[model samples]
Target: MGSSHQTVIVTFNQPGASFGQDAVAALEDRLVGAIEAAQAGEFDGNLIDCGEVRLFAFGPDASDLFAAMEPHLRAFPARPAHATLRIGNTEQRVEL
Candidate 1:
């Protein structure tokens, strides 16, 4: 992990009939793929879905993880909502 931790916060809109299970699974795949593709450092992170928002962290830090998550940034707003990834202490408003 890097000196500064990175965190990806996935804010989900109203979940579909699947009850977010599908979304969660897909997110996992996306995170793995992005990490491999980007060659990001190893870290510990998980998927956190808060009804209105779903957060995905790559590990204990957010730098490498943030770099790894670019591939999966487009998988959102199937209907109309928002998803954000906060790498550092400051919250950056990423376009969905």
Candidate 2:
């Protein structure tokens, strides 16, 4: 079987029914520093319009990617947030 790449996906639920594109764009910009600081992952953009925003990041190490993005995800003014950390063939869900 092919090996799975390590990945971290942080999701923030919108307080309202949906999110504004401008806000999502701004949020993406806000995480640039964190991603760069990790020095191990790349922000693979986000998926929106589902009453939540999910940030996609992939790296050689899932832990490094999660560590870098955790704080930013926590500081965001959104409730019911969580992250899906995929390590190889396994996946773990972490509440932010």
How accurate locally, in lDDT, is each candidate? 0.56, 0.79
lDDT of 2 by residue, 1-96 (tens): 125458888888866745577866777776777878768778888887568888898887888888887777777766688999998778999998
Model 1, span 14-47: residue lDDT tens: 6543346666667667777777666664423444
- Per-candidate TM equals 0.57, 0.83
| Best-performing candidate as measured by lDDT | 2
Clashing pairs in 2: none
lDDT of 2: 0.79
List runs of model 1 lying over 4 Å from the truth: 1-3, 15-19, 41-50, 59-64, 76-83
Model 1 Cα shift for residue 19 (angstroms): 5.7
